[model samples]
Target: MIIEEIYQSYLNFLKEFTAFKSISTDPAFATDIANTARWLQDQLAANGFKTEFITGYDNPLVVGSYIVDPKLKTILIYGHYDVQPPYAKASEGQARMIEEDLWKAEGWENDPFVLTEKNGRLVARGAVDNKGQIALHLTTVFELIKQKKLNYNIKFLIEGNEETGSPNLRHFIEDHADLLSCDSVLISDGEIASGHPVIEVGFRGVINTAITLTTSDRDLHSGLYGGSVPNAARELMKLIEKLYQGTTTIAIDDFYDDVIAPTKEELKNHASFPFSIEHHHRVTGTKKLFSENSLDFYTQTGLRPSIEITGFESGYNGVGFKNAVPHTASAKLNIRIVPNQDPKKTVKQFEAFVKNNTPSYATVTLQLGQGCKPIRINPKSELATKAAKLLTQEFNKKVLYKYCAATIPIVIDFKEILGVSQVLLPFGNEDCNMHGANENFEIDLIKKDIGVAWGLLS
Candidate 1:
């Protein structure tokens, strides 16, 4: 009956939390982001948490401490308060976003900011990626306190720059190690895999690579000098072609030097999971799945490195294409690295490759964006067992202990700064559309996760 009792209150809290445009990447929402932190500080303080703000960054870090006994093992809850820029700024190298951003994105079941009940799911921005999961923790803690059942000390390090690649996270965690230190960390920021509960062992590391080629000072008439002048877009395309010789391989030297191969046990576990190749294609909207050694879908997703072109900005793309040879062409790429690969080192290799391949007639520059190293917790660790048991029991289904291909960006920082055993307990559905338009979460899963949080922590 705890789920029933907390139902309406849960909805109300999420409703207010989702309304804020706390986009960490946009300085325009700086005030709104500050307000969001204040709101969380107040809420955590109200729940008996000793809260403080770590300011002076693009987004502030909210630290809340709640201690019950000196001898109790303290567990840190890590989550983000910031979100992806809701609306897109096309002029600033953004794809024109639909709606008021996600709110009006087509095919949405309901308003993204206003929680709408569609079947047993709640549709909203930040509904499941992070905000929904954070709400589950808060509610569980609130109930635990009310019932006098808190079993362990809790230290919450809620950040606001995760969506923008957690630019200041390493600095923040290193500075406030004493405040956020804990015996173990529990993060609810992944998707439930295999139609059941999942214990994610690792998330892939990421490095955003940008390539810009300038062939002229300004746009030149394609008709007048099309044959004589070099096309910036063509020059960049040639570089990309050299980067990816095939669909699944990066031609850059030393790209795979640091990749850690999975253990025999890990491979056997992945093979045991009920993964469907067809279903994987359907969910991802891809024509085919690719990996280095023709690994299974799950393994290919989480265990390998990937080079994805996220954005390619160049040329005349407005109404009625102006016949002009583009002078400046740029490409945005995300290189997803697996365990043991150093993100900076990998970027260096990529830089070397680009430098070596640039045509003499064209000038090229490489800009490295945000990147994080991948992290993996031993699936058989005691902490993993404890969290996995609670999650499986809550869902009444088999749990998959797996690796995620995408990077969380914060977990590595947690390990470096807090030096705690990290466990990923994913409560969000796999098809939640997190970070995409029409994001949503199953209300039942949220409630179940709250109950599981209570069972495990309390």
Candidate 2:
């Protein structure tokens, strides 16, 4: 009855938050984005927080402060109000449209903009990543304020454009550093692994780029030129084959030059966590895993660097073959770099590697996107240790320190700009399906996360 009542109260707020459809990447949703920001400001203002709008960026940022005492320790909370659009047009540079119909095709059971409960999970677009977390945190803070149990000054820096690479977040921090100054930061934007508590200590950097190869000016008749001339598709396939040594390591020269291996202590801690290769295969629907005999999943994904060919196109992929050779072939590359590795420098190295490996007949072009550097927090910090112990007690499991193989560009900005210690706690479940349809957060998990927040803040 208590959780149900709390859920009902939080549900009212979450419903209002999720109804805005704050998809920041699309211009059509600009009004919705602004509305969402204003709505959040109102919520904070109503809860006795001194709320204001931080601007001069693509999307306005809602900042809410509740200072218990000027001399007390401060913890700034960061979350986003934006949700990914239900679909993306091809003109957006995507290979295909992400149709909303696919939500139902993928077993989505409720309207993405409506917060609904099914099987003890709250489902909505930003349910877990991260409007749900925002609501949960606000609820905790509200209770704390009501009970006069606050010990630390609280600040909420809720942004609206995180899904779009946080283009102006660094500048926002730079412009308002004094207003945003804090002793530490609290984040619940990630998820727990295998139902266990996690303090995500680090995340890999990222380089997004595209590689295009041109073999000829136009498509040639495959029947006549199949054997006489180089097929762009075949050439590109050859280059791709050389990108990897076997199935595990990248073939690029010095690709691992700056990668820092897991420490003995980190490995020992990682080994204690539970993992199942069978479950991984079943969940991912993969035939097999890479280097399973040698590298553990966490080591490969978290500690190591990897290259993924996210999109590839060369020849005809239609109902029937065109019976011609493709003149141009392009592949999208998403490179994940580790700590100590410079994303820009790594892209340069990758460019050189691709060009050098291409055949003389083929010409190559590289188009680069923004690069985000990897970040590692001090897992042994006093705050982190204390939070980890609290989480372990709350979850009744040994808290695991996770090195996420993903990129949160703003997290890096927080370290470089704010220069404060961070507690990277994850409050959602592993199968919350973040960024996908039917996104949801477990009810019990929210209760647990609020308890953890109460413990940390109190």
Candidate 3:
């Protein structure tokens, strides 16, 4: 069987892939990112893929293709070669020291970056969130080629910008339409919703904005005009609090105008899923839960729209109290939008609401950030159904089909531009610490995930 061989090869590839600090945000890692791309290109070439590097303004995309039978279906596999920024500066040295101490206390058998086999887990960055997935797909194709088992065409588009919101992927896909044309696409960048096998069928869109409130031209001493002058900080807080007052529902007019209700079938499926509210609270370390309505907590987080205040900043944050009316105050907010809701339209409505409600003495400025449309895929596609059956057969577990609250903008672009349905089969755990400190992937999952991908292709 190709399973054992594929597992060993994945380990070898992961060790090398994780060693390169392909941090996308830092210009210092430019060469590292390019090197990672080249390495992936070489692997594709060796596996009989007609491969080339599509050079970007900053990073390069590794594109490869193979044709088996013109009549056979074509599947495009997508993954990223870039990794999130790592903490390596002197200011973070103390934190690293503390982390090392903690790792020791936890009795970690091997180094986090190195491919260490302890008990059963493979400890390393990129082991599960992407590099391992990429390696698995590549190795599966390689094994098929070696055994002459491939019966369909495959195209691989490994990018280096997914960690940075995939800003340039749309242009690259548009420019290379002919190369990426396929009947379907598969993405391995998501996770199992509740640590069980799952096939994510949809993802929520996102809209981020910064709200700034300005009052006086300069700071004013509270003693000089304590009761007369307006405070921008207090005004900003008032505007923000208007989002969720007394209840959890946002007070913005028409905020839920475009939200589509979940179907009866979807609601039934969610109710049958093996989700535990107590487990969720324990895992998140939350003391309480509150919402406008009394619904299943999982339904609210997975299917409902949410608005959050991510950060707030104002005047006079010092060692002691300044007691001043600040000139300006700002808060960063993000909204996870559901399907049928237009981010631009939502932003316009929010702006109008703020303008109409702002007090006469204060001014509110709304700045819109990146936004993406929600995407849903047919759960009954041949590829998805076949993969689901294979996963259940192999793992002896029921696979859950659900939509994720997080956003992946390119999924919509792929559907619109390439006319391809994408399937999300995440092998990582929910608490994999993706995009956070001490991020690590379980080694056992990495091994079994290779088997899962191979089984899907077979």
Candidate 4:
């Protein structure tokens, strides 16, 4: 009945919340980010939360606290306000040359910044990724406070730079340790595996970087200088080809030497999870599985490391042929690391590998971003057990312990800086299409998240 009562109001709130293009990666949306932060603060304050803006950073962080009593246990909720760019930008030596509209190219039926409902689904940029989840929690808190049923001290740290890897997160956590200290932390950002409710026990870490190869100052005519000069694109392509040895293993030295394998019990639990190969194919649009030594999906993602090429820009790709040789070529890469692997050391190894493999005529440069360590939470912790029980009751099915392949940089910061137990309850559907065009969420899952939030906070 509570879910039914709050459906319309929650949908309205989500529509307003998702309209802001609070993209943290690009400075062109600074005003939009500020507006979003203010909107969050005002909403929390209206719902009886004492709110403050954590500033002096790249993007402001919104913290809201609702304390009933000092003796009560505190629950800190973390979510990001930032959404990835609606389109990808092609850059040439740090200068963005083209802003390609991926939304249109990907065949989005509605405006990405406008929340649209079609066939019982909400479509918008960040609808399910983070804004929708954050909106659901806030609406649940509003209802709980109205019904006078909240029992725990609730604190929300809604940040603005998660899409770009939270560069200022470490400093923020260190400076506000006392303010963020809590008995437990709750996060709802990722998707449920195969639409089944899951308690994510661990997640892989990640680092994003770009490698640029420069052979000359300007684009050269391929017809005049085809074999006389070095082609940056060709040289960079050869370098990238050496990044891996076989199909699954990275060729970089010691890349996979530091990963910790899952235990027997953990493997057993993964085998029992409700996984469907058909569902995996439906979501990924591929019929084959790329795993190491023919491992299962869980083992491949949760237990192993991966190197992915996210973006590449070189030469002329236009309506017509330019017949020019590109002077510079750049490739963006994302490396997923497992537990016990140090990010700094891994970056060094990656750098050395590139340098050794690169051609002598070309000059290579590496631009690195922030790195996050992997996290493994105890599945049997008191808070985790409680969450499992609540999730089972809500979804009317047994809860699964998931080893998430994706990374959330702030989760590890919460664990290390606040020293609190954490519970990750995923509420989005597997086909939510986060960080991509036509990103959407199901109305059913939105209601389910509100119900779960009520149970947790109460």
Candidate 5:
């Protein structure tokens, strides 16, 4: 009854937060974005935090501080209020009209913004990816405040554009270093591996690229020019084949030059992970896994450089069929890099590799997006051990340590910019479906995370 009451009250605030529909990437949602930031400032200010707004950026930032002493240690909490929009096809992604139409047509039968309990999970769009997790942190702080036992200096950096690559955070941090400086930074933007408490120690870097090949000006009939002409689709596939043609290792020059292999201790720790290839298959909905024989799922995912064809398009793909070879074909590759790998250098190397592999008949071009560097910390450190112990005691389960296989660019920025160690302490379940439809957060996991936060002060 006590926890249910606490959660019930918290759910009311979460409902208010989620109702904003704050999708930052679309300018049409600009008003919603601004209102969300303003709403957050009001909520934190009401909760006894000194909240202010920082400007001169793509999106305004909300900074809330609860400083009890200058002598006590300080911790910085970072989170985003942005939620991704409904999914869209790549072609329709850039055009707002098309995306909007699709969003409206989807009918959203369930009302995504409303907070409801389904099988004990709190459901909403931004519920777990950040908003719910961050809300739980606030709830914990409020609980401590109610007992008149709150201490330490807390700075909450809640941004509105993290889903849009955090376009202004680096500059804001650089400009206000004195105000934001702290001993440790806490991030709950990730999730638990299975059902255990994880003090994530590392995450892979990323470089998303698109390579396009043009063989002719227009689509050619396969029946007439099938053998005489070089099919753009075939040429593109040939170049893609060379990227990881025969082996699991990528074929780009200097791609792995800066990659750091897992240490012996790290490997020993990885062996104990609750990873299952079968479970992976079930979650991913794939019948087979690549390089399963040569690499463990954790090793291949967390420690090595890998390439994924996130999307590919070549010839005609219609309901019936088209009997022509398309003039242009493109493949989107998202390379997941490791620690020490420079995304700029990797892109240069990838460009050269793409050029050298293209045939004479086809001309190739590359489009590269932003890159994120990897980050690593010791899970056995004093702060991590204390947090782990608190979580284990609260959950009554063995705590887990993991290297996040995905990329969190801001973690690298926290280290490189603030010169402070950062820890990813997730408060959501693995099946929260972050960035996907029907995303939700587990209330019990949030309680465990709150316990960790309480331990930090104790």
Candidate 6:
């Protein structure tokens, strides 16, 4: 295949796809997601593959399959069509117009939704995470098929709800196991911590919890009950504090009991990365590190378990201070667990801890939300070795292997139902500003990723 022609076609398709604002969070973009899925299905069909739409509760999954040889290894290429909402709010003055705030910035040099080539960078939303990556996979397969370069069967599982924790992906996977059965899965959705081409071997799981504590029926005058009543806000704070004893490790019982320590080789490979504790703090603009042992920060983030307090609410906030004790206090928390730690067991332990620690006067309520299990694949798997070798050959740099902190629910479900492992090969940078204002992707990286995909297929 002519590399130049393939790269140009890939870029054109990327721009056209990125123009559609398929924001999964907004109901307004429901049609847009469907349109994108239709376009993708058409593209896959045009490439000489059997295609079908796996309808779900919200958006559907676009699946396409091609069999080169029944005996050849089958690979599942998974990606998402949904994107996070843009930051172009009409209320933010001057930022409303696409040319003004949407475009022209140090990192963002053009409209995030409109593709622009500036300083050899492609500025657009989903350019890298992950419309561009998805396009790369598609173009790679298409070009190979066109040139008769492919030698194995390929299955595409493009989902539309990955951004929202893949609410329906588990059921989809279970229902379509025969259709999606494959030797392995390749996902281009995560990035290397070192900002280099790498294969993600593992991903952490998450358990979200909402806790509410009520001490009284309604707000009470602080002066009248200052000495007698137990403040709900104070009690809630105590409960939360007990979960984190001024240390990075969570204080919840048995939280780490099921955590599987990294292998000796995995730890050695992690140490090979040139990560400076001081430089990380400087880049984050923090005066001090969170972990007691500064060297443990990387482990805590990449391999260890953690509890995070996402939000908290209590009492009133106005011009003047209201002298009243809050009747109810609530907090939102997310606990990230490592491999071997079941999300259900972790949540149960957390609830039990809160119940045992709560005062008799205060009633505690625990609401469990979404939960998923952590996943880790062998670094020496045949597919992983092949991908790493191809990435090194294409990029002329050693491939970095790292664990992603975020959760991809479908990955776990795919493994459980289909018995497949996914390789996360992300083309996006760390500071892509996803789910934030002025999200942008480097144009040069987009082109390079196309080449990388081509090389991987080769």
> Number of the top candidate by lDDT?
4
Better candidate by TM-score, 1 or 4: 4
Assess candidate 2 and give its TM-score to the true structure.
0.89
At residue 344, candidate 6 shows an lDDT of 81
How many backbone clashes are present in model 3? Answer: 1
Question: Poorest 10 consecutive residues of model 5 by lDDT?
Answer: 88-97
For 109-201, candidate 4 gives per-residue lDDT tens digits of 777889999878899989988998878888888888899898888999999999889888988999999888789998989888766788898
Report the Cα lDDT for candidate 4. 0.86
> How close to the true structure is residue 131 of candidate 3, measured as C-alpha lDDT?
78
Q: Which number leads on TM-score? A: 4
Clashes of each: 1, 0, 1, 0, 0, 2
* lDDT (Cα, tens digit) per residue for candidate 3, span 1-458: 56777777777878888777677867878998989999988888987889989886358998899988889899998988787654443232244466455444444444445655544655555666577677778888888878777766899988887766677788888888888999889888866756578888788888888899999799999899877888888889988887875655777888888888878888788777786767667656677776546755555666677889977888876455788888899998988888888888888877888888888888788888657877787878888888898778766788998787787777988988998777888777666666654456666666667777877775
Better of 3 and 6 by lDDT: 6
Model 6 lDDT per residue over 23-42, tens place: 88678788999999998999
Q: Flag the better candidate by TM-score, 4 or 6.
A: 4
Per-residue lDDT tens digits of candidate 1, residues 274-366? Answer: 888777777777887677677877778788888988778788775556899999999988899998898889878988898899888888888
Model 3 lowest lDDT segment of ten = 86-95
User: Candidate 3 clashing pairs?
Assistant: 122-443
RMSD of each: 2.4, 3.1, 4.2, 2.4, 3.3, 4.3
Local error of candidate 3 at 451, Å?
1.6
| Per-residue accuracy of model 5 over 267-296 as CA lDDT, tens digit each | 788778787777777666688767634666
The TM-score of candidate 6 is 0.83
Cα lDDT for residue 261, candidate 4: 73
Better of 3 and 6 by TM-score: 3
Which ranges in model 6 have alpha carbons more than 4 Å from their true place?
A: 1-4, 26-29, 69-71, 86-112, 116-120, 215-235, 278-287, 292-297, 313-329
- The TM-score, computed over Cα atoms with residue i paired to residue i, of candidate 4 is 0.96
lDDT for model 1, please: 0.82
